[model samples]
Target: MGLLPLNYRRPDHVSEEDVRRNESSVEFDEKADASLKSGYSGTSPGIPDALTFDRILNGGACPPCTVRDFMNYLIYIEHAAENLQFYLWYRDYVRRFDAAPASETVLSPDWTRAMEEDTIARVQKDATGKAKKDAPVARELFKGTDFEKAPEARVESRDPFATPPRSSAGDTASLSGSQATSYVSQAEDAFSAVGVKQPFTIQPFRSEINRVIATYIVDDSPRQLNLSSCEQKAVVRALSYTTHPSALRTLSQNIENTLRRQAHPNFIRWSICNGNPARVTFARGLGVGTILVAAVGSIILTLSKAGRGWRALFAILWVLGIATLVAAAKGMCVVLHGLHHRNVRPWELFVEDNTTGLEQLHEGKRSFDSFGSCNSYEDEPWVVKYQRRFYVRKVFDREVWIQEPALRQIQDTIFLQSVLLALFGASALTAIFVAVPAGGFF
Candidate 1:
């Protein structure tokens, strides 16, 4: 059977006073049998475990008797659970990796920035002084290097589409200088065809270039220091993996857990209440009005010589009134509940072990799959169709449903109650005066 909202206000047949009075009169065996029948094994039958019940009872404001209150309480619990889970995950992470200096240094942005600044300052101080002294000599030496010549002027061929000649099988450098130049021209032409105006060039030694400049200025060495493409890639890969065992997986799991916890409660609450103030107030009024109408109609029908059909109609009215009262008291929409079974989390499972709790909170693991799929009316099963049609309003092109204006909701409730009252009065009056005196069916 689906989980139903408990009516806390409704007293069981045996009240506290009655239980106290009958305590000594009842037999122990009878009491135990009664508990067993109610589905209780050890303590109170049908009641959750002591700790779980206590948590629910103390959860907040008696689970809210109205839709608006229920939704607000659910939202509060969800947000609180999420914040608590995040705090726990962070605390665990810090405790687990506290001894690792590299982890701490990598995680802290402030520490990383401070280390970078120190390295840059040391490099500049060592290189600047000698570079100023050897500026003229360094400039003269750089003139002879390839860096001083234009790329096109140095090439033997101006033709951009030229291809390299096939080399002899024994030649060690398969593509010689001329062939290499031809290949470079072809690549440049290809780049230009795709709208690139600059020549295609590979500079896989940015860090090496900086190091060489620093070395030339400080040590006054004419030798250039550079890493090949393969060497540069290897160095980069090594640097990236310096901090192994990434916290990404752990952090992602924590985030998923947080969302799961919030989603379950929110889905259950929405399924039951839908958080429409107008609808809640209207339902409450209709329930009360139905009961009052039933009472008046019953009295009139009893006093009159009404037919079997009229008597049966009164009976049906009484049943409808009672059912409406129950729904109103629980703040649940009967039509919605019938369509979608209640699949609220059990009281004990709310604080289940972290992993178990997270699994339960997950949408896929939910008993009612419709909650996961149909977030809005556009999706399947149409769970929220009625709510969307009546309660929602467009504000700035976005639909707003909850927290409608108090005056508007009140007005709607009053109109509904007035209509019910009018119907009840007319029916009662007609049955008593017109139908009774007619002497037959009518």
Candidate 2:
């Protein structure tokens, strides 16, 4: 039966029609194969292509990774900013408490020197009662104020009974009053003075910073599975500049053009794939992952060894190396240096929100002429109306169409999936190595 089937499959005789059919079939098969390879690999076989370093960002296709990375970056950036602010605050507090001149002291050489010594002492104080009492008042009142100042004014007056009364002394008499009365008048004057004292206004706590920071995180992190246009530019440039000179000239020119056309500084610097927050956020995640993984590995290694000093040292060194590599990868040290240059401690002050007007600008369907050129439209698009009617019919009649966190939800999902998949893959690989052979591996 098998032989008969094989015989039936074989061609009995070669004819023009048969040859044509065979050739056609071969051609079709070739074409299909080519299509499949092209679709899946996106490259010809045996040829090296540009590395897709950008796609690894935010755990490609994983929405949860995207959300996790985005949120983590914001938290990290904010924490860094807060730490910087705290340091600044602490430094100012120390200076104010230590070197602050007596509120009423004259600034002679001795006094100035004494104030300087006092400041030093206050910064390095023992737990003494009197020093502690004075520190708080000085710190609160003179926080971040200049430490050196001229002496307080002295008002010398003659006793009313001792001074011989004369018409010429009328001006002095007019100025004199009971000490309580004078104190009241002085207090009133101090209170009424139009900006006599420099207004100790706290620097405006800009809520805008938070929004910008958030936007920076979101735009920089991975939004989708791939790098955004801006992120592609950054990663490509980074790779090209580091390795290939051929890409430099074209990249530089494109970078210049992009800078001219785009408002973002990253466009000019070729630092991001797209001006979008998501892609940038992903790049940052890559760096963060390396650091975290290294640290975790080191901890696990150290823990695995029960009080072994050499193993702990090796683990520590390995972790440190990983940390250094991560810092190098993400330009963290450079960023820290830049912060220092600006006299900023990144961990001190923080922003709360990060969205720009771009969101508002791009949110809805815009109006356009018949040619599809965008124009300002007073009327909302019918699609919006349809969506409201079909999906949100009850809420459609309302004037404001409050935004749903559709993108955020998507990001969250992707992030979670990526993390789970990664963990699963890692666990499977570990299990294979640890248990598949079922021997003495562990």
Candidate 3:
């Protein structure tokens, strides 16, 4: 049975005649095949597309790879939830600030080079211990192109995405809206200074800015972001003057770069191992098969009148097999992880949620009247949800060919230092086997 092309957009007014006519036409099948090929093997068959990084940074990156998808991994696996959370908030924050009336909003002066100030430098240099290790690497890779400065350049470009996004909205959370009037929680109240007067220029968004600082920009914050000491101070200092998006854009540039460089690639590699047809097969088949055979074999030999050397040998094999299974599960091969490279696999492009917004935008149910003349809502499109790869059949899928690396290194290091210690264990087990002479002969 043929599947609908992933990029297939359901037309607004599809008559019965068109469906019957298209079903019989060979052109339908050809188009579907071509689209699938581009997604799997890149636009040019076998040559990986260079747009991978750019797609990831912008919304609607490599299909199945979206803000929702990455959020799960970053929050659970990496323990760096604050970066993506702050980035999402900033995008929405900036969107609202942009759509606000000129009379209400005021632009702040350049807070650039704030990181270069002597106070910030001293905090970074003197920062030792876990603070130094956990500190965010300064933003460079995605500089200038990021949304903090130029939201239009990347999002507005006519460049084709891995999957076409339905629409974008100027859903800026304006202060005049219900959000500003909503009851301030005790936590939010802590963000504002009691006696100090907020700057009159940015009176509209001063509360929101203070809340952002308390949650993401301040030291000892509940969900503290990885801003340098001086960077944090700079954001606070700039806010005293203006409440423009640029005022705290150091948050934008830094967090965007951090997630793109670190969390994104890791998420991709994870998807490859977990979703790729071949990798899944290799993991379940070989990974499980090896575990059963090695474990059973080791147990049988270990209980018999086997020599210590023989038992030890099987034990090593058993450990190595477990390592292989683990690596397969993580979709990490030492070479690829070390090299920081991955292959784009078939059926892995993200599928956008097309149920509501797109058809409405086309059919006149919802308004998409801005940003390349799109998005009806205040912040983003109503139906911008991204779906992961859909699986069909998996028979004779290719090999993942994994050998896990981290545990292997740890095992080696521990074994080398603990070799003498291991001897004591070996001797203890050897004596137990001797004391309880095996019924079965080797």
Q: Which regions in candidate 1 have their CA more than 4 angstroms from the true location?
A: 1-275, 307-309, 341-442
**How many clashing pairs does model 3 include?**
10
Model 1, 1-442: lDDT tens per residue? 2222332121122233443354446433445435533543222222223212112223422222223233223333332222222333333544554555653445422223244344335434434444455556545666878745553343223345322121121112111121223323433332232222441122222222223222211111121112222222222222222222222222223233322233323323333343244444555677778767866765565566675356446544555555555554545433333332222222212333575446435532322221122111122222333235444231111212322222122223323444454456546644554334333322
Model 1 vs truth, CA RMSD? 26.3
Q: Can you write out model 3's per-residue Cα lDDT over 33-91, one digit (the tens) per residue?
A: 34432543112111113224344445544333545446545644565666666776777
Using TM-score as the measure, name the better of candidate 1 and candidate 2: 1
Candidate with more favorable, higher lDDT: 2 or 3: 3
Best-performing candidate as measured by lDDT = 3
- Give the lowest summed-lDDT range of ten residues in model 1: 216-225
Any runs in candidate 2 off by more than 4 Å, and if so which? 1-284, 295-304, 307-367, 371-402, 405-409, 429-442
The alpha-carbon lDDT assigned to residue 261 of candidate 1 equals 32
Question: In candidate 2, what are the lDDT values of residues 1-442, reduced to their tens digit?
Answer: 0111111111122233443354344432335434432432222121111111122121342321232222232223212122112222323433443454544112211213243344334423322333456556546666665632311111124345422221221122121112323323322232222112321222121122112112111122111111122222232222211222211222222222221122111111121111113223433554456546645654454445333332333333333334333333322222222222211111111121233233223322111011111122223233243334432232112221112122222222323333444455444433433332222222
The TM-score of candidate 3 is 0.39
Instruction: Tell me how many clashing residue pairs each candidate has.
Output: 1, 59, 10
Which of 2 and 3 is ahead in TM-score? 3
TM-scores of the models, in the given order?
0.27, 0.17, 0.39
Which of the numbered candidates is closest to the native, going by highest TM-score?
Answer: 3
